[model samples]
Target chain A: MSYGPTPWVQRHWDLRAAANFAAGGAGSGLIVVAALSGARDAPAAVALLAGLALVAVGLFAVWLEIGRPLRALNVFFNPRTSWMSREAIAAVVLGVFVLRAAWLHATDSPGAVATGAAAALAALVFVGCQGMILRAAKGIPAWRSSATPWLIVATSLAEGAGLWWIAAAAHAQGTRTGLALFGALLCVRLFAWLAWRRSIARNARASAAMAPAGTALSVLGTALPLVLAGVAAISTSPAVVLGLAGTAGALAFGTGIAFKIALVVRGAFNQGFAIPHMPVRGKRA
Target chain B: MTRWAMVADLRRCVGCQTCTAACKHANATPPGVQWRRVLDIEIGNFPDVKRAFVPVGCQHCEDPPCMTVCPTKATKKRADGIVTIDYDLCIGCAYCAVACPYQARYKTERATFAYGKAAAHEAKRHDPDRLAVATKCTFCVDRIDAGLAAGQQPGVDPEATPACVNACIAQALTFGDLDDPSSNVSKLLEMNEHFRMHEELRTGPGFYYLWDRSEETGGVPALKRLVEEAMDLA
Candidate 1:
């Protein structure tokens, strides 16, 4: 039987999944940045823990999208040939490393480089897997295009850096690096935005496909944080005080979540049969 | 010990969704989740528009980022540069999904498994709870493993090429090991002005594209020159 047109409810679920994943991923990265940016104190720790909670929820949300949670192990049996398999393995490896780092921090471990390097590598791997996933898509000009993966990386770094800056007020070294990172993230964000705009103009359908989600994400997730970050940078009334900077940071973080969710939701609904798959005929009973 | 690669001749690609369809079938992927996809990119204005059918999949980079960010070590890169995922360990956090520069990873949701003919009738036969995890192209890992066990070359397959590679009526997709310099894929890369999806990132992606001369000769030549210059900086 030919599948009828996709229903709105199904489309809504698809979009929601996308949004949750995007937001969750972004949230996880932000938490890492927060830790790195000097959220070692109790308040910062609380915030980091909160972010982790979000990540945990997001992970479970993603699992709900799979076909056989029990057989998910099948993905790892052939790492020699499958990127999906490799991604799965990497996800586990990074998880252990990051959690260890968090634990080390909690237990007052002496190895800073070990923890830092592991977290950094995990961040990079996370970004790479995202890119691989996008690169693997066969069609959908918006997604299959090369810029998709790069954008994911840039956005993560940008968002991470932004979060780091917000969390930097709690630490000395984090303050310096956080400032530098903020500047760098701004530049990358600008470049990615420009590239996305250019690509969209060149390919209308591609642009349209991504625009709904992109606009929502940018407005709520990226722009809000950026505005807050800027305010925080300009204001001099004690960075952590209950004023503009603190408020902006909170808004940025919250918006980032909203933005991620919106993007995912849009992506889910936008994807349709640009090219139809061969309809599988029913098995002879 | 197992390096994987793919070569695509832009001239031969007809933009058919065969590879996409085949991939969905082989992987039994849910809707909105494709391990491999073909891109129909049209450049220039309507009158001067030139379209190219580029089949994209995981580059399985030498330096895979997915391996780093996985809080659970779900994704890993083999010694031979092939990137794989351990779904069992994946908490479905989708961190790799955002980190990937290619957007190659996908998160499965409830209605994803209900596609196609069999999926339509037997949709209820499948468990509903397994819809929450990340997924992407495996380069047909199961087939590749079986092939290697039987002493087959890295890219050659008797059962079926990758879903996308096998589905190509134009025979546009080529799969093999780039480590073997004598491999057809290597030869193709060596002879042609081939390009990976995003060469500037220095990820060392395994997938390569050979653009048609006609398309490349026009404004693409200028773009290529710019890309070369940018690569030098990168």
Candidate 2:
């Protein structure tokens, strides 16, 4: 709540803003994971729809937060200079491919794999756009760090992998490749988070506020998920493997959302004012 | 090549809050919304502390972050370096607010008066276009533009200058074309040791702070003076 010359957590964007990053990032990641994992049939269609649904939910939150919803279409006006505009464009690209792939997969048609691959690429581009949106906000030291984009992308990918594992398990399918990807992304996410945290270490208030979330992400989101996925990979029993994989997926996905929420809401502190030189009273020199 | 800029003489500012009042009065800003404000900063240990009042608002940067981050092209910098917002185009997402390093942008959704109810003057001056959109200090652009049409110099004419600059009792604030060598702001900058806040960010801020007048006294630069004394000892 501190204001004036001191750094303060921004109030303009609250929980709703966090929801955009969290849900959008994860949803885009899931689309990529589902496609890469070779999911087909109804499961592939369901995954496509599920991913799009999450993205839609995130967009809804953003629409609700805006002061003038009627003018929301104007967001596409500045693609040349604004990452937000690029994100909107990327969303359309993702939607087109996902819908095409979903239709092909649901009907067991040819070109399902190719369309899924195209959708995955679109999803990756969308997630990158989301990361750059936060990175372009130079006023927030935590978000403007060079490592921020990487952290955001890595966490979203991890979240996607986690969701893919659960979907695969629900369909009584194998979770080997998705589990491996999830574990690797968890490790990558941890590294990215550490780098991002280090970049903003000079901002004590923001670092302190985000410390708990960072710790939870490392332990629960990364370490615990890694352990569970490892156990699931080695287990011979189908039920046990499914249970472990699903639990790991839930933990990683849930922690990613919580971490993003903390980042957008709690860690987005404004760069406060500073007077480099002080003036002496009644003195010319 | 008119680049409007403001120079704040830190030594003369007395933290009177007069400029803030003038700005609010001129703009009819909602309660708790201040387009221009001064910060009272106390530096050093208690026994040797020194206090300074700093006037801060939008720097109206040459490369404004708010302008770059505005999704709808709502925030823009004019040819004269004045940053403005197109309220009709704004979606009120507040993305520009978070993008402004100076914390100068504000977004208000509803109209509220200073005393709970809108008075006659407040109601008369209230701007519906500003509600639910991003707004900031325009540096009194309307006055400057009007004054220009009237063939009056901005810094020299009270009617052409910003309300805050006109209301500064101590003459702490000066506004003029930075591109003009003989302008008030340009002369003040040349005669004083001035610094722009967060200059390292390379925003090329239009606002400058004059902290010392050593050059006016024909004294050696601080760096040169130190080098001379060291050479003398050697």
Candidate 3:
């Protein structure tokens, strides 16, 4: 009565939510690479600092999205029941490792691997929890598919790999290998997305919601990035390789944000009322 | 073990929307927000078309997805089967609204009036605390609780019944403890050809609709035979 005769969606989460996903993706992505890259010098500092900064920005973005930003801490009250609360906890743990990694980088510590690995694991949880957040929304069938987590994981990894490649390129470190991993992760995302779309297509409403977004994910989000990476892969010239790889990284990051925007904004539709039998003149609907 | 439920007899309902009006008056919901509504559904091709009135609202589901998804644990189901939202605890994230298949939940941050300005009656019934939070049909929890404290039985006493049920002019709506076989709702459900919406979801909704008395209402013999095992277990 309030919204629709058919199901309706709550238009609460908007661009701020998209920002949350993008910033969180970039942050977690940076930490993931920083943790695994085994970078003991200048590039490690760049990754650690940027990663922590983006995570903070992402947290703030979500905090701003809530009606009562001051009441944000109250979300911690239901960790046992809510993925959102768990995301907050994971964010805190990731922050701790992030700080330690930054300190290790600044202090020129040789045992940076432990701190980096801790940060990376925490980063994975932080990003994967966002997927869990979507999976927990049982109302939107499109978000609840089993493939959602894998897709998010793949997206996060690709975004992180892309950032590492960019940072490495900027620091004159070899960028080709990191670009390869980023490309591979994007491929993982493309496959997982296809699986997700197939699984959710069984539901009529979910299929309707996924149609446009799934197409965008397949064509603009997946194919465009991969094709660019292939061009970068084949190029023997230094400038050509760097520029193409940079463009590929940029596309991969944009795709991550676009996919989430489609999900958090467009793909959210409520399941409407249903009746087993349609009512007729002298009958019940 | 009080499980409150509602049973609507389609034959008796006139689709006058008195229940919808009564709920709005009782709840003082802001403009565009309704706690109860009667859906007029028409079916069949032109010449053979038929229409029916369906009272749709929160089912007070046994396994409410809204409750499961609330990040602040603001949405909860009572032991007595009334689903409610703790407004103070809710962050107005609208997660519960999206999770509810029934679309019974609503979130409104802005204050709106029916006819430009808030009328005296609306102003009287308005709940300021309800703003910026997920709100829905509580089955008139306040009335039930107050009546219980005053030694009145819910669904039995007029003062305790939901505003919608009490205002049904045709007596189409019955309210009672579903767990009590002697109760009006339970008795109505047992005697009539009744069904709950989205039963396949296994949410065990408290609202039941008595559609028709037709012998064919049960559908084919094969269908009956297929359900016989489950019915036998029940």
Interface RMSD values, listed in order for every candidate: 12.2, 1.2, 2.4
| lDDT (Cα, tens digit) per residue for candidate 1, span A150-218 | 766666656555454455444322343455455556456546755755754655544565576556445
lDDT of each: 0.57, 0.90, 0.78
Scanning candidate 2 chain A in windows of ten residues, the lowest lDDT window is A276-285
- Ranked by DockQ from best down, the candidates are 2, 3, 1
- Give me the runs in candidate 1 sitting further than 4 Å from their true place: A1-285, B111-130, B212-234
What does the lDDT read for residue B129 in candidate 1? 38
User: What tens digits encode model 2's per-residue C-alpha lDDT throughout A150-237?
Assistant: 9999999999888887876786776577778778888999999999989999989999999999999999988998898899999999
TM-score of chain B of each: 0.82, 0.91, 0.89
Candidate 3 has what TM-score? Answer: 0.90
lDDT of 1 by residue, B64-180 (tens): 655554555668877766688776666565646644555577666555334345455446445443355566778887887777778776555646356677777988788887878
Top candidate, metric DockQ: 2
Against the true structure, what is each candidate's TM-score? 0.50, 0.95, 0.90
* DockQ score of each predicted structure, in the order shown: 0.04, 0.66, 0.45
Q: Which 10-residue window of candidate 3 chain A scores lowest in summed lDDT?
A: A276-285
**Single-chain TM-score of chain A, each candidate:** 0.72, 0.96, 0.90
Q: What is the C-alpha RMSD of each candidate to the true structure, in Å?
A: 13.2, 4.8, 5.1
Rate residue A217 of model 1 by lDDT: 46
